[model samples]
Target: MRLVPIQSVKEGSILAKTIYDSEGRVLLKEGTELKDITISKIEYLNIYTIYINDKYSDAVIEDVIKPEIRQKAIKKVRDVFYNLEDYNKNQNNYQGQNLYKKSEKDFQSVQYVARELIEEILSRKNVMIGLVDLKSFDDYTYQHSVNVAVIALIIGMKMNFHKYELFDLCIGALLHDIGKVFLPNEILNKPGELTEEERKIVQEHPKNGYDYLKGSYDVSVPARIVALQHHERIGGQGYPEGREGERISILAKIVAVADVYDAMTSTRVYRKALSPNEALEYIMANGGTKFDYKVVQAFSKVVIPYPQGTMIRLSNGDIAVVTKVYSQMPLRPDVKIVYSEIGTEINSIMELAKENSIVINGLEYEVPEDN
Candidate 1:
């Protein structure tokens, strides 16, 4: 099954996944038959196009692809949450170092998933994909982990790292947050400002994660180091160890930059999500202090600061929606001129970077408007 935009959704098509709200309530369920009114109702389902059956191409709207992805993501989050919660309640419940061992084993599995995704993207294969919806904490966690791993892998590939090293980097990134399992759910899901003590606990997760992984047999040294050192700052202001520039491992520094960018741009309980461009701007400004400069530069090159489907305001008082991400100049993507300054439909696609006089001043919509 492939994705089709909601505007292109037809009456006989079936939904591939259950659409949910920020509160975890289901807005629409999978297998629901589409209607024009159904398409017009929901607001945040932008980016995704509907899927149709490949077999008949007409007899059925078999939504096999996205639904499976949604189910997998949901299951992954639920399983991790429960397992972590269980471990959190009993720190010494393990007879030996099983907690860390279990985490390592889990990492081994998820690392494979990360590698497969990277290979699929790199090969330009026609793989099924459902967009990462950032409407929930679980989505933020799972998707950010995957995104960081992909970004790091891409950078590693470009830097000419061997296959073994790239695989290790994938392992390092996927397990970077495995220590968050040790923190209390209240702190992990805290919606308000965290106290100094709470902030310290949050910061200690890296070392805690590393220690746990190190205790387990068969875990690579780089995996443990990455878990511990991903928070180290280049300018010596980061947490846990606060190691200076060269002291921090190169892999850790790379993951550190990718982690911060993905987290800041993703939606969380505390604040509304920053646009991808805004997150990149924040990263670029703090590169020398909070992150490695070269890593940040690499990320800027690979990640689309203005990903497709975002709405932007132009200097000419026109409003447009992003339609495609170009290989060059990620900050300036191709946009569809959806509305004029007065909110009239233009139905035209405009290449912003190629346009001679137009300039995008800002993004106005944090949440996408439903079709």
Candidate 2:
């Protein structure tokens, strides 16, 4: 199965994986053949790309975390956020004992899910994290949390972190933005630029999340630090705390890189999502200033700059689909030539690292449906 942009998807193509809506409802089941109406519906839902079975491309992109595990993790995050929101709405209504019990349960659930996520990522270190941004505007917070956890765990694995360290890192990454649950909906989802005061209010999330976790008994110190310091930069420019250099915890440093990357790549009310390659470049460029250089290097090693099944234009003007990614050379991957510059068919696979004269010039947003 190969991943393809929705614009290039044609009728009769088999769906390789089930598509789910923001509410966890399955919209298209696996093996369902795409018809015009189905395609239109997917497009209407704002889905940009999907997995489809194609004989021409044998490339397979696997999810680092299983679908069931991911769904459960998302649901767990949603539940915790919902509980927090509910508690804020009626803090006086619930007894202290009852509230404490609920909070404990939620923290336990997060730890269990975090361990599972770490194991899943460690089990498949070679598989590039290629999660599609299928989140709806309403569920953005929950989905974004899960995405950060997965990305952080991947980077941590590449750094050879121990199992316990990985667990703390994953938990911290998952709840790094949990404080946003307390922000007003209008300010959190505002489509326009924020005022100076509003920006300061938004920046208080790290402290707010840290305070929330500090009261919990199950959270580790590393995890709490992540919630507090994920936004702290190496050059003392970050918010909540302008911590620089060794002042920032290693766990928070890893989470910070993951948080920034996921935030940039996710679509928001204010801006369009950056492509994965563009997001990575932004992170790399900011390394040692906005992010820890070592953590950024580990992230670059694990993530695929140009993921498989993505179409690209070579410097030679050949349009091809990425067939495979090499760990050593992420910028250049194997590509299967589907069309020449003149738009003629040419079925040939080229290992980009072996071809010194060719380089990917640009990514093709749309490809011929007939191919």
Candidate 3:
């Protein structure tokens, strides 16, 4: 299977993986053949890319969290947020108590999903995480929460965090942005520059999330701290509280790295998403100030800088598709040469770490047609 942009998807292409809607409903099932109307419907849903079966590029990118688990987790998180929204709308109603109970149940379900994700990651210590963000703008928050949880868990495992500790960290990561649920939809989704008052409200999400999580009888102190302190920077430049260095809880610090990484790599209302390599570079550059250095170090170990299925140009003028990523050498992954400078098919795989003379120049969206 090969990952292709929506524009490149043609009629009769087979979907290699199931695509889910905002509510976790399957929009298209695996092995479904694409028709003209189906492709248009996919574009209308704002999906940017998809995995399709193809003979030339059959390399499979493995996801640490399985699709079914991820979809269920997204639904659980969405339910919790929707419940919170409903409660906010009827703050004076007696149904508030029952809604809170339902929210708590949803939280428990999310935690269970988190544990499963941690187990999957732990089982495969050698696989570099190849999570691609295929979410639309409307589904960003739900997908992002799950992605952050997965990223944080991988980093936590690399740090040798115990299972219980990993559980708290993952829970915290999943709900770190819960405060945003309280913000007005206009303010949260506004595409233009925010006024100072709007900016302050946006920054208050950490404290708001912290307060919300603190009321839960089952949440741990460390998990609550993650909601409160994930935005606190090491250099005391962060928001809600300008906490610095060790003042931030270790769990919060770890989540901070995951939060920023996912946010940077995801397309928001105001900006385009950064490439995985670009996002990692940004994280590395701000390691000591904006993020905890050790956490960033751990993050570098698990994230695939150049994800598989991306077409890239080599410094030597060859065009290749990434086949696999080596955790130890992220910048130099295994690639299959799909075309040469003369626009001829080469069909050879190269382990870039061993190819000392080669360097990746930049990414290419599509290979140039053979001349």
Candidate 4:
């Protein structure tokens, strides 16, 4: 399967991955044929790209979590956000133990999902993640929460966090943006630049989320602070608390890097998603300044620059696809050469770490299928 822009997708092509709607419901299941009407429906939902089956690109794209697990995580996130939205909409007269019970239930369910994700990652012995899971723009926050949790878990695992610590980190990272539930859809999904006032309101989400979690939920202090201080920078230039250095807990610091990486790599309404290399470059550039250097190191260790099944161009002008990424040498992953410089078909696997001169130049999105 190959990820292609919506416009480039042909009508008769088949979908290689499942597509979810704004509410995390399955909109188009995998293996669904992309007819004219189906393609139009996808376009109407503001989904800019999708994975489609290609005869030439034999590489397979795998998500970090199982399909059921990812969907369940997304569903839980959606439920929590929706509950918060409902509470905000009805806080005036709605009073009972029910609210507290629901909040407790939500937090508990979230904890279960986090623990499940941790188990899955732990079972895979040093799992490396890919740049997948781009849902609709309207569902950005919900999907992003799950993705951030996964990324944060990978980083935590790299740092040798035990199961208990991973639980707090995972739960905190998942609900880091819960405060955004109070935001108006117009402001949250605004296509244009946010004004000064709007930006101020946007910056208040961390504090708001922290307050709600602290006051109503049964989460740990570390988890609560993650919502409050995940934006905190290493040099005291972050929002809500302006915390610096060790003032921020290690869990929050870890989530800080994870949050930025996911946000920058995601496709937002205002800008396009950055490539993996581009996002990593930004993170590495800001390491120890805008981000914690130690956490950034952990991030570099787990996130593969080119995940398995990603088509890339080598320095020698050959087109290749990534097979595996080494934790020690993430930049130089194992790749299978699929085409020669002159567009001739070739199939050879090369370990990039051993090949001194073969460098990965950039991502290759458009490879021939009927060449």
Off by over 4 Å in 4: 22-25, 93-102, 314-318, 334-358, 368-371
- Candidate 2: where are CA atoms >4 Å away? 1-12, 22-25, 43-48, 54-56, 95-98, 125-127, 131-133, 342-345, 368-371
Q: What is the lDDT of residue 55 in candidate 2?
A: 61
List the candidates' TM-scores in order: 0.73, 0.91, 0.92, 0.90
lDDT of 3 by residue, 55-138 (tens): 446667667777888888888888888888878887788443665465778778877887887887788856555646577788
User: After superposition on all CA atoms, what RMSD does each candidate show versus the true structure?
Assistant: 6.8, 2.4, 2.2, 2.5
lDDT by candidate, in order shown: 0.64, 0.82, 0.82, 0.84
Q: What tens-digit string does per-residue lDDT give for candidate 4 at 235-313?
A: 9999987888999989999998888888887778899887788889899999989988989988987887777677888
Ranking by TM-score: 3, 2, 4, 1
Q: For all candidates, what are the clash counts?
A: 4, 0, 0, 0
Instruction: Give every collision pair in model 4.
Output: none
Better of 3 and 4 by TM-score: 3
Residue-level lDDT of model 1, residues 1-371, one tens digit each, is 32344555566677765676433456777678877778877423432334333221222222212434434433443355457668777868865756656665555556556556455445643221112233345455655665666567766665667777877787788778877877877998899999999999999899887877777664579867888998889888887888998899888888887787767765566875565667778888988877888877676666655545556777776666666667567656777665574445465777878886887786643222332
Error of 1 at 4 (Å): 15
283 Cα displacement, candidate 3 (Å): 0.8
Worst 10 residues of 2 by lDDT: 125-134
Candidate with maximal TM-score: 3
RMSD of 4: 2.5
lDDT for model 1? 0.64
